[model samples]
Target: MVQTARVLTIGEFSRLTHLSVRTLRRYHEADLLEPAVVDQATGYRYYGVDQIPVAQVIHRLRELDVPLSDVQRILRTPDPGIRAALVAEHLQRLEGVLDRTRAAVVSLRRLLEPDPAPIHVELRSEPARTVAAVEAVVGSGDVEAWFAGAMAELEAAVGDAVTGPPGGTYDNALFEQERGHALVYLPATAPPRVGRVHPVTLPAAELAVTTHVGEHDGVEITYGALGTWVVQNAMSVAGPVREVYLVGPRDAREPAAWRTEIGWPVFRLT
Candidate 1:
């Protein structure tokens, strides 16, 4: 007679795997892990003792927050290289989520902490300059990607003509309603007409300016501080806000070294 494999009931298998019965049932439903057999008369699930390793692998992957679908794919693939690739891809996604969370925590800490010392606000008159710029009505959700692409285009268009740090003008509606017209520009001796970058003259203005030294995640506080200073000093916001990227990602790889100048066009109320 041939030797027979030991068949364990679902409950026993769950205990051996250290996984709950409910989870085992879910894994079966997801087709991630399946038992070896079922009782024809009782319609009960049973697992071969040989399947213990498979159950443990499924449990470990689930613990790592891998989606059920990916887990299924990982398990179904017999090739070790494919399985490792699937796991590595999910780990990369987790790393991105962690990075965003860490940035958010830094911003939240700045918001919850006691107000810092007053930021120095200065008055300066800017002269009109020719620029290669990209203008669009952009939504808040797409602003970062849009700005990056626009800057890239401006860089490609102007080449050696770019004279100063890149800057942008953001309409109030972009903040108030989450969508509005905006312009990302590079100062140039003469504007280059290429791609979406076009010749435009950025007008001269008197601005109440303040520098934000670090990541832009907490720059809202700088804006609020600057706005308060403008109101307290009897200055009125006269036009769209300007942001000068003095030491941006292109200039410095570290966020700590980035310097952004926020310029609020202002006028003395007559």
Candidate 2:
């Protein structure tokens, strides 16, 4: 009875916008998309035909999982450019989340396989050598960003010419306790000391090394395999873990082509 030539009842608006009546009521309560008319005596709601587009926009924003506050900002913004920028910002966040999700799924699939393939490892004697490096005590969550920044500083200080692949040395606590001292270094003889970048003497050790192919996200599996191998071989860890970048992101565009060598400094157990 409330439906008229100039307005639509709740059911009519729901059909047009493809939103449920309950959802419309909730939106109304939220003051996101209030009905244009409300029957005072019956408490029935009616929306103007002009609100169809706005209702549709709200539905689309919700579909993208846009937060209510952001949706409000996007809907209320007068400038189309600003509106687009807000939506674009949310989309970028979604992409980061999707990338992490895909990486996790890939790792999980490999882990779930019935017959996991064995990894090959080699033993090497690494000598003490001073190299250009940055050292910091960082959290596991901040390691990636810290490494990127440190490497950039290293590149700036050391220049493009390098004798060998750059590497990271992570102490046991960094993995075991999730926060500890970590070092990233690029091989350069007589490398300059500037800012956080300085020369570090890498101590000599026997290392059980294994190369992890593809992206670093799933490289944890390789580490697990290497640990298993070391245990089977009666070798106990003697020092910090070292990750030598054989063919890393700087060397290859495709993650599939990247190779990282993980080394565990070890000692034989009786």
Candidate 3:
């Protein structure tokens, strides 16, 4: 008699793949992956020893948090180059998310640390100027990519008039929700059309502004401090917040040389 290959049941496959039975079932139901065999009467699933490698790959990809659709796409492609490209794209996205997370963490750390000098808030009027800008509704996860693209567009349009730093305007509700609209721009004498540009009239108002020196990673601390000052001085926010980039990353690659102004429009409490 000829010897046959061995097949493992779902429980055995789960142990071999280090994946929970529940997860395996989900993968099967999603048609993302299927067992090597299924019993006709008992309705039990079994996997061949040869299926172990595929299961491991699927398990690792899922661990990396790749979307089910992408995983299916990747597995369906037999071309190694195509599969590699898909994985690389996901990795780049993950890195961007990690960078934003690090920025938030740094901001939180600065907020918790002791400050020797009291945060100063000054009221000032800003002049209206043309700006090359890109506006979009972006979530925290998508902000990095949006910033990169917006900055590139601004640079291409400004050629030489981008004297000051790049900055942005944020709506008040952005912090509370997953989606927020941001208008990122480079200050220019005359607005130039790039990817997306529009003539916007920024109204003159009394603004409580504070300068943040160094990387923008911890700049949220400055915003928080400024907000605290506003409340303590009996003032209420009246409009959207504006960030004036006094020194841009393009001007100086050094994070220490970067200067940002966080401005919040406010009205005195009656």
Cα deviation at 227, candidate 2, in Å, is 0.3
Over 4 Å off in model 3, which ranges? 1-6, 9-12, 21-26, 39-45, 111-117, 122-125, 128-149, 170-183, 193-195, 198-206, 213-220, 234-239, 247-258, 266-270
User: How many clashes in each candidate?
Assistant: 0, 0, 0
lDDT of 2 by residue, 1-270 (tens): 565789988999999999999999999898899999999889999999899999999999999999988999999999999999999999999998897899899999999999999998999999999899999999999999999999999999999656789999999999999999999999986778899998889999899999999999998999999999999999999878999999988888998999999999999998
lDDT of 1 at 197: 88
What's the TM for model 2? 0.89
Q: Which candidate do you rate higher for TM-score, 2 or 3?
A: 2
Q: After superposition, how far is residue 253 of candidate 3 from its true place, in Å?
A: 6.1
lDDT of 2: 0.93
Question: Where does candidate 3 have its weakest 10-residue lDDT segment?
Answer: 1-10
lDDT, model 3, position 241: 89
* Per-residue alpha-carbon lDDT of candidate 1 for residues 188-243, written as tens digits (9 for 90 to 100): 88888887989888899999999998888778889999999999999999888999
Which residue window of length 10 is worst by lDDT in model 1?
1-10
lDDT by candidate, in order shown = 0.89, 0.93, 0.82
Off by over 4 Å in 2: 1-3
Each model's Cα RMSD? 3.2, 2.2, 4.3
Compared with the true structure, what per-residue lDDT tens digits does model 3 show for residues 204-238? 77889999988877777787789999999999998
